[model samples]
Target: MEKTKDKRREKISVATEIDRLEERRARCQDNLERAEFRSRKEKLSEKERQELIDEMAIMNERVQQLDNELKMLRGENRRNMLLSVALLAISALFYYLFYFEEDL
Candidate 1:
């Protein structure tokens, strides 16, 4: 029971963490888009343009990292679910095969 509860807690925390990462990813993407738009505008100093490019690059990198982390978390969640199911199946088999009374 405690293990199940802990798993539930972990699942909820992972979901919350993913939500935060997704929000950060969206913000980074929006910032990159805005920077791109600014770069496309009429005129800007070379330094300003370079700064915009740099900011976009950083944000892009952050978004990619968050995406990777999210994928890893999702994969972990799936593995945990599979493991739980397998354990439950094994316990059920044990209960039926070994724990049951034999009456002939």
Candidate 2:
């Protein structure tokens, strides 16, 4: 009877160890699957990053073009203003010389 009881206890211990090993194996498999999923997610398009860079460069170039256009327009406005002032001055001088001086 004692030998039989010892054998039963040994069998139960071996069974518990097997259960523990199975649980460990399941956990390791889950971890491996999770790692593979993460690796797949990481492997995406660097093209999006490059596209963003290209878009920024194009925007910068457009801004520079607008800035240059603004500067040219401002210079043109100044020249027009100077020409108007000079014409007004010449007209005033001609009026004085032809009419006002004769009346004096």
Candidate 3:
């Protein structure tokens, strides 16, 4: 009688574990189905997605063009600054050569 009771207890424990595992499996499957449904519903049409991608590409190109323009402007500014410095130096040299004689 004790042996029979032990066997019944083991069977009950195994059945409970199986039921728990089955419930978990069902929940996981339910979640997967919900996710798949949401994915299908939330997806954009191909044409609309492509249009958005194209618009982003055009904006990126425009940004690159603006960067190039800014770089050219910076280079031009540097060149102008160097030219001004050179002109100032030449003016000082000429003034010293011609006007220093008068002072002396």
Candidate 4:
């Protein structure tokens, strides 16, 4: 049915969005590691060091936000799965009552 197709599309979209956010988080983590290595390995002026620190802070915040978003999305996915199972069980019960009970 049309509603089923729409639900499927929404789920796929959410899954893709989650994947995109995870990839972005991975890139941010890589950047953080490189920045830390640079700070430890290179001698820089005070301004440059402070700028690096600020940049790292921003990236850290973004990573945290991404993690929160992923957690929310995963929880939503779990809820959807539970809803689908409940629906299937209800449908099966109805089918059995309507189609099989008369034969008994």
Candidate 5:
């Protein structure tokens, strides 16, 4: 029972973490879009333009990092699900062999 509870908690935490990261990625995308629009719509000093470019680069890097992390988390979640299914199957087989086969 305790192990089940722990597993449930871990699954929930991973899901929530994924949600948080997705929200951050969305916000970063929005910021990048706004920055692009601003760069196109307004004329700015060279230094300011350079700063905007640098900021955009940083945002892009962060987005890439977030993408990688999200991918890893999703893969881990998939593996966990597969492992759970396998374990359940094994348990069922054991129960059947012990309980039902003996009566036959």
Candidate 6:
């Protein structure tokens, strides 16, 4: 059904967003590593080191937000699938009780 297809599309879109955020998180981690290395090798000022740490913390927060969003979307998709199954079963029960009763 169109509704099921729409749900699938939405789930796929959410998964895609999660993947993008994961990739960005990986990049952020790489940057953080580089920044730490520079701070040790080149003797960054305290302010410069703190700035890098703050930036990494912000990136980590964004990654955590994406994880939470992914969890919520997955839960929604599961709920929709359960609802579709229940509806199908109820429709079948109705068909058997009413539509097929005349043939009996």
As a whole number from 0 to 100, the lDDT of residue 9 in candidate 3 is 55
| Cα-based lDDT for every prediction | 0.83, 0.61, 0.63, 0.91, 0.91, 0.75
Per-residue lDDT over 40-99 for candidate 5, one digit per residue giving the tens place of the 0 to 100 score = 999989999999999999999999999998998898878988999999999999999999
lDDT of 3 by residue, 1-104 (tens): 99997787566643354455455545545554554455467676887656655655564555455455556655665787799899999999999999998888
- Quick one: RMSD of model 2? 37.5
- What's the TM-score of each model vs. the native? 0.68, 0.52, 0.52, 0.82, 0.81, 0.57
Which pairs clash inside model 6?
none
RMSD of each: 6.5, 37.5, 31.8, 6.0, 6.2, 6.9
Q: What would the TM-score be for candidate 3 when compared with the true structure?
A: 0.52
Task: Summing lDDT over every window of 10 consecutive residues in candidate 1, give the lowest-scoring window.
Answer: 95-104
Q: What would the per-residue lDDT of candidate 2 be over residues 50-90, giving only the tens digit for each residue?
A: 65446555645554554555566556657877998999999
lDDT of 1 by residue, 39-69 (tens): 9984889998888888888888888898998
Per-residue lDDT tens digits for candidate 6, residues 2-60, read 99977876666555755665677678667767766776788668898888778777867
Runs in model 3 lying further than 4 Å from the true structure: 1-44
**Number of backbone collisions per candidate:** 0, 0, 0, 0, 0, 0
Segments of candidate 6 deviating more than 4 angstroms:
1-43
> Candidate 2 — what's its lDDT?
0.61
Model 1 clashing residue pairs (backbone): none
Question: What local lDDT does model 4 show for residue 46?
Answer: 100
Ranking according to TM-score, highest score first? 4, 5, 1, 6, 2, 3
lDDT of 4 by residue, 29-49 (tens): 999999999999999999999
Considering lDDT, which of the candidate structures 4 and 6 is the better prediction for this target?
Answer: 4
